[model samples]
Target: MLVRINPASCPSDGHLAALTGERAFCSEFKYRRGMEIFGEGEDAEYVYQITSGAVRTCKMLPDGRRHINSFHLPGDMFGFENGATHRFNAEAIIETTVRITRRRNVLDAMTSREKGAMNLIGFVTQNLQHAENRMLLLGRKTSLEKVAAFLLEMDQRQDHPDMMILPMNRRDIGDYLGLTLETVSRALSILRDQNLLRLGGATQRRVELLDRDELARLDA
Candidate 1:
């Protein structure tokens, strides 16, 4: 099921262009849920910034296991790469809209090579930081800790402070957090039982953090 995202105020075209950082070079595109935005090993010709929906960056192993690297919400950027081809696959987790700019167009539109390079470095560093955090979560965190950290991370990303309408399923979460499906479900149930979080809505994708401090402790 798709989770509805309600932005406080929608931005105009001008604002969107500014947000994309490519101005006139940017074009809008929409993708249906489960659509492949870009595939692994494809040419990294364009960079994308989410306009309103969620997306996921993933990798498929030789044995056919899927590993989700990151979940991108509105305003998050993806597809920026230093290499000629994308290292991982990118897919729309929900109905999505994005402002996309071709690599050559972005370079041509830049005022200076220095500024463009700086911008690229910034994006790379941001991505690196997230990757580092996720590495820690997977390498050292216990199942409960992993799930707690995932919730806190998603809580911060979602529009609401205490509530989150998760765009992905438990299986998706498990893949991202390096946990099994049963372990993910069990962790969530444990959190709910401890009164640290509450599952709401008919679909139960709506999660409300009832005790953030306690949850933080668990994550810690």
Candidate 2:
């Protein structure tokens, strides 16, 4: 889906203009659930910001096995790899809207201001930290611990005080956690059995935490 920024809420008029360029060139393109945003090895000409919904980035092995690298939610940015082409495929997990900006414009803006460069560096560093954490999660954490860690991270990111709404499904979670779909479902069942989480409705959108401290301990 096409997304446009309201001029009033933008960080800076000049920056916004530079980012969007001449007219509001914004267009909304809708993607059905599981639609590909961009494929692996495609030219990375544009950087994307999630306007609504969620997107999953994944790499696939020659044998057709998939490993999800991360999920990008509203306001999250992706497709900013420095190389000419993207290394992974990005797909929308639900109906989604994304604001697109040409990479050349962003690079030019960074060249004009040291602050822009700093911001880009900070963004890259944050992504690196998340990658390291995921590496730890997949390489060492137990199945239960991985699920617990995932919930805790989602809670922190979404800042849901009473209940957390998951935007992705079991298969997406499984690919991310390096487990099968059945494993992810079983892990959620185990958490529910332990009274650590309450699943609401058939969609599994509502998730209430019963014990924050216990969840943290499991993360540890």
For each candidate, the alpha-carbon lDDT, in order, equals 0.79, 0.79
Instruction: Please state every model's RMSD to the true fold in angstroms.
Output: 4.9, 4.0
Model 1, which residues run further than 4 Å from truth? 1-22, 108-120
Residues 20-132, model 2: lDDT tens digits: 43333333455768889899999999877776788999999888988898898876878988689999999999888766667776677667764766666777788899989
Candidate 1, residues 1-220, lDDT tens digits: the string is: 3333432333324323333343445567778899888999999998777887899999988888899988988877778777999999999988998767677765564545446566655666777888899888999999999999999888877754757889898999999988889999999999999988899887678998998888889888
TM-score of each: 0.85, 0.86
Evaluated with TM-score, which candidate comes out highest? Answer: 2
